[model samples]
Target: MSTLEIRDLHVSVDTETGPKEILRGVDLTVSSGQTHAIMGPNGSGKSTLAYSLAGHPKYTVTSGTVTLDGEDVLAMSVDERARAGLFLAMQYPVEVPGVSVSNFLRTAKTAVDGESPKLRTWVKDVKNSMQSLAIDDAFAERDLNTGFSGGEKKRHEILQLELLKPKFAVLDETDSGLDIDALRVVSDGVNRFTADGDKGVMLITHYTRILRYIKPDHVHVFIAGRVAEEGGPELADKLEEHGYVDYAGASA
Candidate 1:
């Protein structure tokens, strides 16, 4: 089984004011077939953690290490990290006006897997993934994320997740701005990806509604850029009931 491990990870982003620290000694581990949820208030560095793990250049690793399936992820380039089985679904997927969804997906798959899939087979796979995600086949011919709704963008992310089939996935705020129907569709795609025995997931979300669909195996509460609480499925329930007030105050 694959695993992603983070040990005392500190991240900084360069700003005009100088280097600004975002993630403060964050540690997390996710193993194959399991789902972990990270819950935090705004500005707690949740997105920073996701971007750093994905080897984004803007987020520098000031200290600590990230490993995927026992390989050093921090040392790998962003493309190499992706080839090594690391995937990050961003909160805001950038729009590429001239890039059609089908073409973008093909290029991404070729880049990550180091070879192009046969055209006929690849089209079939894309069709199946879109159908599974409840997305219309016509959407594949449209430009990537151009004028798409937030829910549609998030589902498109999951579409990549299914098609790419990475060993470890970090989903950052994927549930944001999704209505109940869209949430179910996105969650179904995630569930399909991890339902097997060799993929792991780290879902970063602010709301518990998505958890109802994915059913995380563990939950961690991020307070002031640190994990202040961790537990089983019940933790998500508690957060839904009382919100992050108590945990947010604990790390103050």
Candidate 2:
């Protein structure tokens, strides 16, 4: 019954010229059990909307408000946002040189829950989630994405989603760098996360391939930093056939 609401969100980032605006004025609402897919051409403010909502320091919110179940999301710190039931799977997961994957996930869970999970049960949960995502057990000891393949990094990202179980997840271009088989595997992970009928997902990507597997409840066309159109899953098929060409003449 919870809702994640975005009202006229405007964001900006620093550039050589000055503070350049990104998200012009995004307005959308996603409730529990709904999967909303955002599709657009490259450089469209798609990622900006995701990062801004996640409270990334690089993107500044010039105006507007984001709320989760009536709680002020913009007012919270980055970590606070996660604790408040918000999650973002970055397009490129950064390498953590010394942090083991197991340690990192557990630490993140601890931070979000304000307490550590029991080691024995947590280990079982991690193993099960990893197995489901087709990740190797040896990876538990490896540094986070230190030398992992693109597909592996993306799998690790969804692994966090399965483990963290946030109220709403905003995935930014997760389909990037994934081959066909790996794409299916990652899509399966996202499907598993949203199958509970109590979580929400905002999947941001350019292709409609992932949509075939994940099946968004709603599809949105993002252009010029704002949502140009919103419709059912049929909109994705149109994008696949016609591409974003019809939506051209708009700048990001």
Candidate 3:
């Protein structure tokens, strides 16, 4: 099984004042076949951790080591990381005005797999995945995420997950803005991806609702950019009842 390890990760971002630290010496590990839930309140550096793992230029890794199966992830370029089996489904998926969803998915799949898929098989696979996600056939011809509803955008993100089949997926608040039906559809798609027990998932969110659908093997409570407490599914229940108020002092 593959492993993604994070050790003493400290990240900072440039503000109008200066570079401000967000993640403060955080550490975690996610192995294939496990789903890790990172829960926290707003401004608690949860998204920072997600973007950092994806090597977003806005967040600089001042000191840390992120590795995927003993390979240096911090050193790899953004696309290189994806090719190495790292995928990030952004909370706010960006709009690619001119790129058709069909073309974008094909391009991304080719880039990750190092070869283009056979046209016939690729078409069939895309059609099936889209159908499973309840996406309309016309969506494949539309511009990627352009003018789509929040639920539509999120569903499209899962579409990419199904097609790309990355070793690890970091989903940043995927449950946000999703209605009950859409949530179930998206959660089911994630379940399908991890059903083989060979994929790792880092699900970052503020609520425990998604946990009901996609159970996590470990639940990490993030406070002030660090892990304040961690437990099994039980911890998510606690957060749902108590919220992050108990961990408020960590930031001070």
TM-score of each: 0.97, 0.98, 0.99
Q: Write the per-residue lDDT of candidate 2 for residues 164-237, one digit (tens) a residue.
A: 98999999999999999999999999999988899999999999988889999999999989898899999999
23-126 per-residue lDDT for model 3 (tens digits): 99999999999999999988889999999999999999999899999999999999999999999999999999999999999999999999999999999999
User: Candidate 3: where are CA atoms >4 Å away?
Assistant: none
- The TM-score obtained by model 3 is 0.99
Q: Candidate 1's error at 84, in angstroms?
A: 0.4
Whichever of 1 and 2 has more lDDT, that candidate is 2
Residues forming the 10-long window of minimal summed lDDT in candidate 3: 243-252
What alpha-carbon RMSD in Å does predicted model 1 have with respect to the real structure? Answer: 1.2
Model 2: runs farther than 4 Å from truth?
250-252
The local lDDT score (0 to 100) that residue 164 gets in candidate 1 is 95
Worst 10 residues of 1 by lDDT: 243-252
